[model samples]
Target chain A: MTMPDSSASLPAAASASAPSTKLHAVAPTALPPGVRDLRLDFFRGLALLCIFIDHIPGNRIADYTIRVVGLSDASELFIFISGYAAGLVYMSAVAREGFLFSSLRVWRRVWQLYVAHLFLFVIFTAEVAWTSMKFDNPMYVEEMNIASFLSEPHIAILEALLLKFKPVYMDILPLYIVLLVFFPFALWLIRQSRLLALGLSIALYATARIYHLNLPAYPEDAEWYFNPLAWQLLFVIGAILGASTRTFANSGMDFPVPRNRWLLGAAIAYALFGFGMQFLWEHDLISRVFPHGSEAFIFPTDKTNLSGWRLSNLLALAYITAYFLRADSPMLRWRVFHPLIMCGQHSLNIFCLGVFLSFAGLIVLVEFSDSLAYQLLVNGTGIAIMIGAAALLAWYRAKERMPRKPAEGPAGGANVKSTALGGGSAE
Target chain B: MTIFHFSRRGSLGWRTAVMTVLLMAAFSPGADAAEATPPQDLAQFCAVPETVLPNGFLKHARDAYRAGKPLRIVAFGTSSSAGTGAASRADAYPARLQADLQERFTLPAEVINKSVGGQSARQMTSRLEDDVVSLEPSLVIWQTGTVDSVGNLQLEDFGRALSQGIEMLEKEGIDVILMNMQYSRRVELLVNYSPYVDMMNAVATQSGAALFDRIEMMRHWASSGRLDFDNMPRAERASRAAKLHECIALQLADMIEKAVRR
Candidate 1:
């Protein structure tokens, strides 16, 4: 694994949330500090849940469920949110800690992300390799070992070290880590002023479009489901939103309208759009344009460029979600919501686990599904294992009573708390 | 006197210029007369000599066996015509037909394979000027209708292209011979296309072009157990069917020999 060898201090931002766990620790308040934004938590949980169903492997129930709920590809939404969230975190860092310190913090996270990435590679690779060897499928065997594992020694080393690969909905971690590298710069521009950041982001976006820049795929098999350069716009937009929470707070994320009317309108409009796009794609209009769901066209599932139609649909969903977040609903206060919140709060951990479970589950289920009853049993067992793993992590975190510690600063750790308070005050 | 002389000279020049203009107008094309006479059958324009055979088959057959000149033949159609499934271009039935024709007639024949891949009769008809009519071919063996049937083009459109194609070739004085498409189970159901093949044959009958029934010939071979259906490789079954196809092609070549001999 190619990992960058760099260690740097990062100042803490945001006072740690109350970490009391005297009870069964069932409350959202029990989670470690530095992670706020309850709405983001809800979405993170929702995205993870959708990913669970999408990767359940040949289960009619999961497929039907995902298709019905429009969670078949919650990855795009999650990635866009990731860009948004990175902006939220790093922009605040740059505002309080100065450019150099914030840049170091971004680098540190990228390192952590790369570390997390190697673990993902091993998990997914082993699952695929094991499954292929057991089932005796030549394609899978070649794909898991010779093609993916050993195709490009140099590039793989570079990816491991720099944490770079083509950004795709599937391989989002590399995309996220790569985008994080630019966040400090993005945030610095935002601090210099929003107009400057906005201008640069647009310029970069246009440049990406004109040049048609894209990440290189694996040399041997050349599979790409995402184009990072095209997707960077979404990330930058997210960063911009994340940086200026005051706007969202003041206007309640642009929801100051009569809540019920806007929610109803958004719901109906989004439904119509989604259904219309799905119909066109099914009947084969968009495919005629690009023929293979390429990101260049303005159509459904063009997640990379975030086609206007998809973006508008997403905005509509965001509005509907914002309404729900503000309004009273059982989903907001349910005991079940707490576990989701825990999973959502510690998303990096949750994502890592979800990736492992899904990869393992898919391989095992695909093999077992030949037998009807065995298929159902396998799916049931898979779901149970996922829940069990989430429980295990929650239990482990509770036992440790771990708090998110601010990085050791060059001047000292005192600078970290001041940075956090300063950011909090600004918002 | 001077004025009279200059007037006389001007009159002479004017008269001479008027006479020249009148002569040019009589020979030259009128402005209203359209110059772009849309491509009339250019094959007839290249009037090549035909070998005249003697009265009886016995005499002409003997001459054919002894003919020293190479026979010129042209074949046209879609992918199958292009010999897509043939193990090699050499194995393509057209090449095989040319070899057979050369051997039997004792003639050094050059076969021009003008087959293009994935072309419907519509496309072929559109390009007839360039591919067939331009060659002024002694024998134009047309193999079409495979794409016509499969591509679901209107039967009327197919008929129009076929009629125009035959008419254009016949106008060029090219001895046109059409080899109808081979049989496929898929096409037997489509009445529109299957009947269009017959329409093509009727056009040939009307236009006096020799009609080769390759479809019927293949059926005969299939019934006679000459077509190796069971023993052939699954992928090669289609190619093996070309044996029957080649027989039809060779039979057409014989007809062309007879026509050219005449």
Candidate 2:
């Protein structure tokens, strides 16, 4: 199981050690099950919400997101967690049901993601198209970023099927879909030799950056927004950590908790350096410091190919996270976090719905008043709707599960032997 | 007093004069305060600070400028370069730049505006060979990001197109100056233009193309009460647009002269 037993006093019993406890022995030799690690759910849910707020352009709340503090943003967090959760679920399946059976399970999840992506594309297109036709502003059609799509729906549909017709915020799912396709192979490779898999992942990343290996987008001479070739490294790293039993609670990265103080200090220092870099941007003194803006000091760390700067910053943040986070911190049980956990549990639905809501929110801001009040309403209502939808979905799933044979019951918290339809299924 | 009949809104002094006029115009009943305002000597309004040196050395362009050779420059961009808001094509920055550079150095310079309306970086890149590379100009000022930002194009895709385009131009031995979006407070608030603007700077730094900070310049002008995009009267719209274009041309000429002449 990804977490220890949490059945009795679900939040408090997940772990016995204090977050600050030092000089602890290596993690308990006996790894137990029957615990659903809410840490994964918590972080994923937070990332999803950040994505939602960030997607809606001009949302003031987005300034507080990870983007301002670090080079990597929600995209890294999302992909990493996707890999981590997949590992926790699928690795167990591979061990119990054998390789071929687990592969089918992997393919099934890919299919689900593919279907979900296609549906999102369709729904988003329809939303933009309807707005383009209905809006009074003639510039509305162009500003919606679907001008080319409307001109040739037939070709656009073909391009979308090829995973090439992404228009702005639609790029996330395509990357996710492609990454999932590579997951089963990565899982199998890790099973062979973890070190070799890590080596290959890094090599592939380097090769992709050097050779500019990337899938092209349609209607432009540009490449995909999130290059799967480059991004798979992050996914693989996450998956490796997820599958390992040596990993500590609340730490998604494949690193031990209660790490040595020196290593912790180094990670904190790097994180602070990254934070300090943000101040150099867009400032008048930037020219004095870098003599050509900060890119000279810190290279173009654009989110295209997962630049080394971005990756290292993310790793440092993960290291820091592993140090402080605990599986069942009392803070996790607070009422404020309940919504985020629920949203995390049903991330796919919530993420898709959030994308749809972003478009609607943008239109409202543009077509009507873009006043402070509307912004407040837009963010407030949008989050409430996501949380409400998540709560309803959770209720509906619980009702559905009530009828099924509770063969494993709550004891099988992380049991992935239940097939693709009912594996760990955090995704 | 000479009005110069040009874009004279760059200085802090002129902004104060303009703001005073604006206030009088608002207060006076049916009075034409713009006409009533006195002529003013401008400081640095849209002025690129003298200390901000061009990051990319214009070695080829410099040598050409020093040799008294005819300098052929390509003005590649979208609407602003096409003189959409400006009164006429002649008043656009490229045409004005030819005049500004010719008068300053008395060197024959041809700044051909190869800009089309409503084109983004991707569309501009597609036309690089035909409209820009074929010209074999010593330099190209690529203005972009407004259309991309307004259209909500993927920022990553925008970055890719820009770097690729700049890299291609550099390969042809042409110095590139990347011009970012022209600013309007409404559009700035309506769309998230900062990322596109930020991406432009990042690309320019990486690719070693000098960035012409048009948005910040215009934004400074607005904040100082120089040219109010939102509040400009319809009667003065054409003149203001022309002045803005002229001021931009003056700054470009100054920067180019500094970059090349050292």
Candidate 3:
């Protein structure tokens, strides 16, 4: 480990205001650790919330999500930020402990994800089946694509263990598991040359896209919903950005951005175009003008294959965000985002909980009322529960981190505003 | 889309015989003579082109109906076919269709609804043998794609299941009429039904099945003021659904008549 005591990334987000920064590999740790860029937690947290909303059927909250303003949805940001966090943490691990130990840690996390996926599958299936039976609606099993599981539990369980029998919202966790398997090698490549690593990742994505290559699923010829082969590009792009500091400045700490007006203008223009196009895609107002569906081509934006439109849209938006909302922006540290940051810090737990809550929310909406006021109430209550759970988990973890029981420790609410990034973990 | 003729014309082999009965059946009192008055009169709902070309693929069903045998049909779909929103099961499109067909013909007609609410095309495909084909129905009116679109399921999966189901029915010499999602302008922004609709059309075209295009047909109703769906109150859904199902039955019966011979 090059800097075992120091983080591979910035020591704290405090250096986000510096003019130039070196990779943690070069920087000496002179300050306290556990600080991460608030943006990662903020955006990742927002993406998690969007994912919860999107998972539920007939969730109108989804209309106001990333789909409204960009071709890329929250799924992209979730994967990219996951890679970003992995790179920020594990790249340093590899440098410090060599590939073998770092890979062991990665595998441990992957095992956790695999277990989490199966656990979710069990809960999601049971809930759907119970709801359907309780309501005397057999189609609920079909809706979640768990009919096979219900019909042939033995075969379906094996297939699910192989990560082939993913019902609707269970695809992302499996993809994450697959991504972590190759992280050791990918991180090694990134350490040698970020461009070469990213270039190889893009090449694989291109080949996958061109050939329509993806892993097949169980009991059906259809491939994985979020094709990992193509999706690795986004993760790699984020990983390289996370692993490498800004190269333009060498004197002082710098945020991971290369500011240029032309690039900024182009990014802004593309993002605006995507926003307008997405608006049209959702409303389908453009079809009305043409009357006979003349020249009204349905955009071939394939989510499964991670179409180029979505990729470019995500990259453009990321750039615009980085250029305008600097790492040290006051909004990043806003008190309003505390709960979100807490949610982000304990993302894995919050994500699993959120997935379950979404289904519960759906059941409530179905069993009760789905009117406007009711929907708002359901959404508000669901999000509040997620936040509250996140805060409690964050508080518990903070207590576990301390060696002694502090006599003057603040309560959970007070600690929320000052909650350190990455869950206050120095590791 | 071959126009059925009520007037006598120089007859071709099958055309001469088909011309005598189908045309009269097509013009059956329908919306124009419907007992309801003013807004309730379903004249505007029946304004669509009645001959949907489902008959081009209805060779076996047409022959059965022509032989004076009891014509049987299975209404397979989700909530809409299962009679959701309507006042009662009889008020659903399938039950109303049986009555509509009986009124149009002297022969015994049965329309069995094997619809399970909230099911997708995938589920319908699985139930093809047990619920629909086992009944030995000559025709299957499959209402699908709504739940799939609403739940954001895979388009390819939906298309594949739909095509497979249609192929199975076609292999059994069953006429298939593919009905799409119900239209609600309010959720239009929330759900992308276009891809599923397009996929349905593609599958129907490929399999030689007829597409009812319920989504567009209802959209047409909304735009033309034939129905007021967007501003409809919760309490009004029951009555409106009854009328909606009745209008659908009327239009479908009209289409069925245009394709079959007496």
Per-candidate interface C-alpha RMSD? 35.5, 13.8, 18.8
Order of quality (TM-score): 2, 3, 1
Q: On residues A224-324, what C-alpha lDDT tens digit does candidate 1 reach at each position?
A: 23456666665666566566543323322222223446445756677566755555543435434443425223332444444445555554565566555
Stretches of candidate 2 off by over 4 Å are: A1-32, A127-146, A246-258, A282-285, A291-294, A402-424, B1-74, B84-112, B116-141, B145-177, B182-196, B203-210, B213-262
Backbone collisions counted per model: 8, 3, 7
User: How do the residues A1-427 of candidate 2 rate in per-residue lDDT, one tens digit apiece?
Assistant: 1111111112221142333232122444222343455677888999998898888765677777777777778889888888878877777778778989888877887788778889888766655444443332321223334444566778878988998877567778889888888788998897886667777998898899888788878776545778899999888877766666323333222233334467578778888878777655524345556654335546446577888777777777876886676553556778999999999989999999888777666655544334556666667777888999999998987676664437667656344334422454647
TM-score of each: 0.49, 0.71, 0.66
Predictions' DockQ, in order: 0.01, 0.08, 0.04
- Candidate 2 vs candidate 3: the lDDT winner is 2
Candidate 1, true inter-chain contacts retained: 0.00
**Chain A TM-scores, all candidates?**
0.70, 0.85, 0.84
Q: Which parts of model 1 have CA positions greater than 4 angstroms off?
A: A1-35, A56-59, A65-72, A91-99, A127-170, A220-224, A247-268, A279-300, A327-330, A370-380, A402-427, B1-262
lDDT of 3 by residue, B130-219 (tens): 998899988999999877765556677787898788888888889899898776533442344656776776566556687787766665
Which of 1 and 3 is ahead in TM-score? 3
TM-score of chain B of each: 0.66, 0.82, 0.81
Tens digits of lDDT, candidate 2, B1-262? 0211223343335435433422323222212322332235333545544444334567668878888788889999887888876777898999999988888777788999998878889888999999999988889999998778766566777888999998898898788999987765334334457668878877876677888888778755554456655445566777777778877887888779888888
Order by DockQ, highest first:
2, 3, 1
Worst 10 residues of 2 chain A by lDDT: A1-10
